[model samples]
Target: MQNNITIRGAREHNLKNISLDLPRNKLIVFTGLSGSGKSSLAFDTIFAEGQRRYVESLSAYARQFLGQMDKPDVDEIEGLSPAISIDQKAHSHNPRSTVATITEIYDYLRVLYARIGEPFSPISGKPVRKMTVDQIVDAVLKRTIELHSDPKEIKKRKGANHNEIFVMAPAIVGRKGEYHQLLQDFYHDGFLEARVDGKIVSLRDRIPLKRYQQHTIELLVDRVPLGWPIEQNKGLQQRLTEAVELALERGNDVVRVILDDGSEMLMSTRFTCPEDGFTFPEIEPRLFSFNSPYGACPECNGLGTVDLFSDDPCEACKGARLRTEALHVFINNRNIVDVTAMNIQTSLDFLSDLTLKASDAKIAEPILREILSRLTFLVDVGLHYLTLDRKAGSMSGGEAQRIRLASQIGSRLVGALYVLDEPTIGLHQRDNARLVETLESLRDLGNTIIVVEHDEDTIAAADYLVDIGPGAGKHGGEVIATGPMPKVLENKESSTCAHIRGDKQIPYPKKRREESKTFLE
Candidate 1:
């Protein structure tokens, strides 16, 4: 394999027939006076060629969606790999796009929450869980046994030695309608009877209902007598299973069991609160995503704000950007919103210290690992101060670029060329070492990194340096020196070498300005 990127007669923008060989799999810095063709060489010529070659390799049908790139104005370029450019441009301006989402940490987080999250009822604040057919059947059988043992409860029944119950499906709840057509449809569908507003009525009869008044209707699925030993009876259990399944299907995941003693129980195949009659849909990864319609706050439509360009949070979700149901789901006592509300470092700490139930931990191991890796990468890029939910558009150019860099590192792709623009910009001096280390890590992963940077620290950390210019624009675009740091610094023609070598310096102000006493107030 070719170990160097060979370029000859590369003329793009202000570049004047520039040609050079950049080493592969190394941290190479392109530093010079601003507008001295560093970008023209790194981005326009090299990265552009790499991208165009990659796009061309795709199928003709796939190429239509990507659109064709106009080949750069260069001749005889070789040894180019697939390239990705991480520029100082916001990847997305959409308010819903955040650091976590961009890095795909939120995607894994969503799956993790959906798999192990415990949902609590908003009304009762009790853990809500979906009931399976076997579970509901078992519970009903237990209730039948208890009822049969109680003579006082059985005394109310006329000439009955066993407990009797009705398995029904609630077709409508607190709905104001005559329901004439609904009854006719059920009657034609072979349903003989229905419980209308707490009274059993034959569906064949013309049940009078006030159209303006609220009513509840439950279609009778089956009537069973718990006389014989039901637990040992296989035939009875099979019948009960069919009835429960039918009831759940008609009731939209809920089934109601009514006893002859006037007591009732609501069973569901969904996460439901028995006391409040609240039912949640099936838990899935999409439910935790604010971008999904099923999970987005209804009041703000998932934007986290009711009004535009204002700090006023949505009254419903309180800027959590999700529905009340989604917010109510928790893992280790923290909801997805609560987790995303924390900064990167805080979130990393929380995840590192998070304790899960044995079963839940088993299910969430891979997901947690992925989230942690991405978070650590963000921290490595000197972005520990940003929140997971911070809008990507709100980040500064340098911060946004670093976010993309962190995401690239997390992707773990190899043998690709990565071009970065001034990753050290907007970063504190204390955090510069961490950022440089991150670049080094990427280079060590067998990928070539070409960074167009002006920071002396970043320049000094490069394994190879290509200093462009004697001056900016027309007088520039020519490589003054290209080699390792010592070799570049020794070159007399390179203007950047003088500044780096301390041959010249920006002197401090001759005199400090006096503090002004005037106040606007």
Candidate 2:
């Protein structure tokens, strides 16, 4: 394997038979005046060749779907690797695309929350618990025993030897519209009767429920009497289990058992609050994903903001992009939406202090590590102030470029040629050092980095420098100098060296402008 990228007779664009050897696994900068063919050489010639070669290696059928590139006018090249370009292109314009979505941090967050997040009641603010089949059955039996054991209650109910119990599955509850299709489903599922709006009616009886009015309906599974010697009745327990299971499968994880005395008991096979009858949907990755129906806010459809004449925060979810139920679920006293809304630095600090149970720790360790690493990458690239919910389209060119750079760093791919265009275009002087360090970190990972930039700080930090011009446009394109930083900085023929060696300088203003009195007005 060659240790250098040898390019001979490259005449792409304005490049005039430019030939050079770029050392592999090093930070190389291409510096020149604007429109002086720096991009033409780094991106068009070298990176383009690498991409074209990779695409050509695929099958003809596969190539039809991919964009084809014309071969560069280079005579010969060696030691080229697969190339990736991180430019100033925005990732997406869709409202659904956020910083977390684009970098895939949200996906990992979804999985972590689903696995260990504790659900609380939206109404009562109490921790919800899921009841197993045995727990549900035990509760029912205990209630029956307690009622029969009360001598005063038993005497008041004269000749009431039979305890009437209605075993029912919730078909629909508090939803608008006449559910004709749902009624058909209930009848087809072997239900003979239904309790519609608190009225027991036969399935054959056509009850016209108002289409626009909210209603509650339940399928009558069975009607049994809780007489003496209830333990001997095995058939009653079997029927109870079947009804509860059907309700859990068909309903939103709840079943209602109405007693003769007008009291009711709610049973659930999911995390629920018995007091408020609040139940959560099954825990899955999609439960935390705003893009999914299970978690998306109904008002804004997971876009977080609403378009009401102008863009505004959604009233229903208040820009969280999740339903009230989802907001109730917490991990370490913070919900998923709250966690995603935190800025990168705050999120890192929050995760550092997070504690989980021993069992939860085992499941969350690997996922948490991946999330922290991606967050660290964002912080390293000077994006610590941005939250996960910030839209991708709202980002500036430099922020978008750095985001792509951070993603590449997370990939940790080796033996690749990375081409970047002005990654420090809008960065502050203080932040430039962090960006430079990030680029050096990529180089240390056994990959070659070639940047097309005019930043003096970037050029000064390069391991190898390629100055492509003595001037811009018609007067440029030929390589004036190519070597290590010290050698390039000392080249008398190179115009780039003139500025670096203090021979030329951009003049500063003699006097700074003062703020006008009317500026605030």
Candidate 3:
């Protein structure tokens, strides 16, 4: 492969017929007066050709959607690669677009939560789980075996006359109602017996109850012998399956087993609290997405505000932008909202100190790695003060460009051409070196970086310098000097070289204006 990009007879815009050779995998800077054909050479001719070539390589169907790029007026060029341009343009104006979405950190977070997040019941304050029919059957069979083999259980049950366990559904819990109609409905549904307020009673009998008193009702589904090997008996297995299904349906996904010794065990076929019977939907990646209808808060519509122009938080989701269920599903005692609410530095600290269960860690390893890498890159680009949930439209042009730059670095792509325009425009002097260092790191990863900048720190950090201009616009289409900074500095004809050598300086004005007392705040 060629180690340089060779251009011949490139004429676009104000650029005169020019030819140049630019080094590959090196940090290159184009410096000149405003409108001096620097952008014409770096963007119009070079980057344009790269984009055109890439679009051309795609299928015809793909080309139509992307539109077409007009080829640059270059005689010939060689050794071009895929090009990515980062300029000082607002990244997005949509209120829905956020920093986390642009960097794809939130996508990984959704997957992480879906895979390992545990749902805790809002009503009972206990962990919930969903089990398959086969899982419930097998668990019950295993539990029976464990009990039969235990000497303590055997001794405790020696005096018990009954060897049968009851599978019951908690139909009603602590509700104030006479339930006369409810009992009639249950009788019509073929239920024979129910334990009312801890006392077993026949549903067929007219049992009167006080209307104002709180009552608990348990509907009996089926009974299994304690010593029966249900795992080996097909009839017993089928009966148990039907019983569990009936109990789950009657109890809103919950079932209870009363052992012969009077011990009770609770199980659920869905993510529901056994005590309160509050159920949650299946866990999926979409469930954590605030942009999707399935996961977004119903009242706020995932906007976090009822009014578009308002700063007040939504009354329902309370600014979380996710449904109640999504907020309740947590990992390491924090939900997705909690993590995204933190600034980059705080997020880094939180994730660094996070501890996960062994099983959860195994599933979350890759996702955590990606999220941490992107967050670290954002911090590296001097965005440690920004929150992941901050609206992208609210950021300054320089901040948006740096964010895109950080996302590009996090991508870790190699063998590409990156064109950046004035990346250090609005950055503080203290952060300039870190930006330069980030660009250098990108170059070290085998990418070619071409930056059109006038920042002294950026220019001093360049590996190759191209100065295009005798002047701006019409007078400046030609490359005045192209080489290492030291060699380019030797060229006295170049204005940038003259300035760099201290031959030209912007002197302070000889006259000063008086301060005015009147001012607009």
Q: Candidate 3 regions off by >4 Å?
A: 130-240, 243-270, 307-312, 510-513
Using TM-score as the measure, the top candidate is 1
Candidate 2's residue-wise lDDT over 186-250, tens digit each? 78878888889988888876778898888889887777666567665687677766766776676
Per-residue lDDT of candidate 3, residues 1-521 (tens digit): 89999999989999899999999999999999999998888888899999999999999999999998999999998999999999876488877788898888899989988998889987777898677777777776766666666646464443232667788898887668899998888889998988899877899899898999888898988776654554487776777788989998898777877766665667777675544545676577888888887789998888899777887999999999899889989888899999999999998888877788888888888888999988887887789999999998999998899888878987899999999999998788988998899999999999999999999899999999999998999999998999998899999889988888999998999989988989999
Q: Is candidate 1 or candidate 3 better by lDDT?
A: 1
Q: After superposition, how far is residue 489 of candidate 1 from its true place, in Å?
A: 2.1
Q: Give one clash count per candidate, in the order shown.
A: 0, 0, 0
Please list the residue runs of candidate 2 whose C-alpha ends up more than 4 Å from where it truly belongs after superposition.
Answer: 60-64, 137-234, 242-270, 307-310, 511-521
Per-residue lDDT of model 1, residues 1-521, tens digit only: 99999999989998889889989999999999999999999999999999999999999999999998999999978999999999996478877899999888889989988999999998899999777888888777776777767556554544232356789999987668999999999999999999899888999899999999889999998987655765587877888889999999998888988765646778788787655656665577878888877788978888899865766899988998889889889888999988998999999999988788889888988889889988988887678999999998888899889888878988899999999999999888988898999999888989999999999899999999999997898988898899999999999888889999988788999999999999897
Q: Rank the candidates by lDDT, best first.
A: 1, 3, 2
What local lDDT score does residue 242 receive in model 3, on the 0 to 100 scale? 88
Candidate lDDT values, in order:
0.87, 0.82, 0.86
